[model samples]
Target: MANRPKKLPKALQKLSKPRVDHIPGLVIAAPASNSGKTVVTLGILRALANGDIAIAAAKAGPDYIDPAFQHAASRRRCINLDPWAMTQDAIRDLARWHIGASAGALPDGQSDGQSDGRFVLCEGVMGLFDGAAGGGGSSADLAAMMDWPVVLVVDVRGQAASAAAIIQGFANFRPDVRIAGVILNRVGSPRHRDMIMEACARAVPDIPIIGAVMRSNDLALPERHLGLVQAGEHPELEVFLERAGAIMARDIDLDALLGLVRTQGTDHGRVAGTNGNDGTNDTDGDHGRDHLPEAGSQVQDQAVAPKDDGAAVSRYVERFAQNNANYAAPVTIAPLGQHIAVARDDAFAFCYPHLIAGWQAAGAKISLFSPLANEAPPQGCDAVYLPGGYPELHGAVLAAADCFLDGLRDAARRNLPVYGECGGYMVLGDCLVDGDGISHKMAGLLPLETSFHQRRLHLGYRLVDIRQQCPLGNVGAVLRGHEFHYASTIRADGEGWLNARTADNRDLGPCGLQKGSVFGSFFHLIC
Candidate 1:
């Protein structure tokens, strides 16, 4: 990042500043995945979003889909706060910028804007303590780091007394992990729920039973590979949200759950969210208050609510004027491209919505074309972005896409900026092997080959030190992203240029292959 600007990137100028906030949030976790974490979390988000209790939602670990559902539930742009992929500073900065900051100042110096630091509800990824490397990047790890309480969701389907054992194990397993409350999921009957609650009280009297969700097949969301289908792809997401919210609001005790998140961290003059945890902690000098920002002000305004249906919603930062209307609004300093061509389809669907929206807000035009549908990039596009997706399943069809491949080849020969991520990274190589061990020729942009036959998961947070200038950033640019792929490299194009390190600062050595204007890796850029 030698050519990087001395000043902070305009994107983070508003945020990245150190401002003290009485930030109090909770992390919803489970013992293992498929424990109804997503449904319960969404239910809570919807139940609390009555326009009175100011709430902000975030997702722990490196996931793109859950955050979308979170956003749909809360009507806010859900931030991805991966403890593994991001530093402590970055995680806190994002939370503060999106959930803690407000547009105007208050008499008590508290926020008077959208984010008044009232309540931050975060959904955990996978199991509570599951991480890419040990438990460093897990949801429990994030809670411990942020000084937040953990609400463990146990799927008590067929067990009654054993549920208390599960609760006790999670609560007492780690001292650093503070299991403040428990939410029982998939209860067969009211009697069943009572039995579990009784068992829980007898086992761990200190741990509170916040709620018990009744089992209902109708409440389940449609799912496929890559987790629950993206919120945008679901036509009845809004209906599902309404139903989930109704169930939670009807079944759960809102006041009791709010009481559980009394004070995970120090309540330094907190005047936003009420501390009604029944005197659980020393909140002597604390008085919860709500302050709204003054009119016609601007500080943090990135989240946009979706329209009527559960259709796709895009989030991007908007420009603001300094004082008067005579001057032009402040603009972003850097952009991905003037006119960008993007490979967008079911085959390539993991692009972050915020990135594209931010680019457009910076005077960049995006032209999306589908390669799976035998379409090439739109004309006059300067840069092409191929996001990660399930390319291995469609290897044969993609290989026979002569029109798409030929066009990409021409674009690569012209030295147009081209970047691939994960599956896109695989398709840019010479050949890709499908699940059946069938070899298929790809764009041949880079001299590399990969196979999914001998699958091995390479998943974690990566800190990248750019070795050369690329469209993403300048040489020496320090970028934080994640790498989660199953493809094993058969031939790695020999010479690599990825300068990366794991979350714990272990050197990953050369990882990516960059050939001319085409550069790719099995890494997915988050920020």
Candidate 2:
């Protein structure tokens, strides 16, 4: 007899993947940045999750940080769905993937819409219509592609009547973007709310005001260079989310909002509003540039290389037109050596949750160790992974980590697979110079030295080609990822494989270091 279906592991199964009548999905968008979308989105997600609702959160852009916060707030696995860099099919598949497993794997038409599911709560990036390349990659673009409704969050502070005008303009701005409803954020008082409600009735009479959030200091999230301070750093995160959820439940029309999302939806719904070409400058879309690199050109920093087979990098170019994200398992960059030792701590905490989750899903055992505490990788582990983070802030502690340093050097000598990125790459190097210009000795596994003292932002999307023998599969394997760091390479020795380019299609040259079995680069893989 055929084997019966075994239950998925609890860690994966614990995620709320409800079999539903329909996926009541909605995009929490704003008229502009800082219009209170993040807080509003979080509150909505937290409230729904607390009520035993199966909800999944997503961000509609190429950001790694905001999704972390969304995941934290919703207590669910959140994914990033980008329009510019990722194909429409990839976006659609990922959208469905974000919602739990459906009884049928086909599109809504192939099977009935009665599949079990989870609702997607997407946090829009920038403004609703802001796209760097034409209007091709905006949050509106994603909404249009998926035929999903957008719930606009408007800050009604300082002006009451003008808020209605903003809503009407947006509702009538683009025919392709559907403005399902509006949420008035930061209202002054009952009178202020009443005035805005009346104005909204006059301007966009049909659009419902699903929420009227009053101005309060409690809902704000702290910010920094990347974005909001990491969701993990928040001490009273649970308390904050609970309070925020209560606020949304008390103020926002959760029942009406859920009703709007539950309406029989189709991908071919009639779009709302329209747009005109008034001639404005926009960056040209990211073309492959058709430039190929010669083999054996080593790079100093981490970068991507072209695959020997050269799969057209621009295959996933169009939105609302393609049919596959070309899903691939993240190339196993760590040793298949029985056990995996991952460095996890404040000083080294940039590992992607998906990669680790994937490892566990594949039945791999994971062991975590802290380099900050001067602890070494536990015995019996065959592979070691050191992810990137703010090592500059904890330079003295890492420098004094003799056990970790010695154990790491011993691992390298023993030829165990070792890898690093940015800060981790710094740890695997000869030395790291902190922002104070003080030097500290590192593992000295790779012939490299990096410095935070000479910091400069090196931020951009990258396409990598694994051209040589390494943990990330054999030669000719290709990967799409990004590089963001303030540290710079101050010294390097032996050659490294991999060539890459910017989103603007500029050559980034060869990058990554490979000395014996130890290797790493600063690029963080997304696919």
In order of appearance, the predictions have TM-scores of 0.70, 0.73
- The residue pairs in collision within model 1 are 1-475, 1-476, 1-477, 112-291, 112-292, 112-293, 271-289
Q: How many Å off is the CA of 291 in candidate 2?
A: 58
Q: Write the per-residue lDDT of candidate 2 for residues 1-527, one digit (tens) a residue.
A: 12212232222122122223223467889999999998998888888777656565888876766877777777777777777666766566556544543313455312123222355678898899986532355899888777678989999899989999999999889987888768788988877877877787677755667677878889988875566777778888888888888887777756546534543143211221101011121101110001111112211211111111111111111111122222232323333456789998877877765466456545677899999999999888888888887788788899899999998988888999888877888899999998899999888899988898998898767777776688767777766667888888899886666777666567777788988878888886655
lDDT of 1 by residue, 1-527 (tens): 01212232222112121112334578889999999989988987877775345566888877877887887887666766777766676566555545533422343323333333345688998899888653378898898877777888899988999999988888878887888777778888877876776676578765656567778876898875567777877899988998887776655555545644443343310111223222232111111001111112221211111121111100101111001112221221245579989898867877765466457657889899988987877889888889898789889989999888887888898899888998888889999998899999999999999999978888778878888777777788777778877789999855666688886778988788899989988878866
Regions more than 4 Å wrong, model 2: 1-24, 84-98, 101-117, 131-137, 172-174, 267-339, 360-363, 378-380, 473-477, 494-496
C-alpha lDDT score of every prediction, in listed order: 0.68, 0.67
Best-matching candidate per lDDT: 1
State the weakest 10-residue window (summed lDDT) of model 2: 283-292
**What TM-score would you give candidate 1 relative to the actual structure?**
0.70
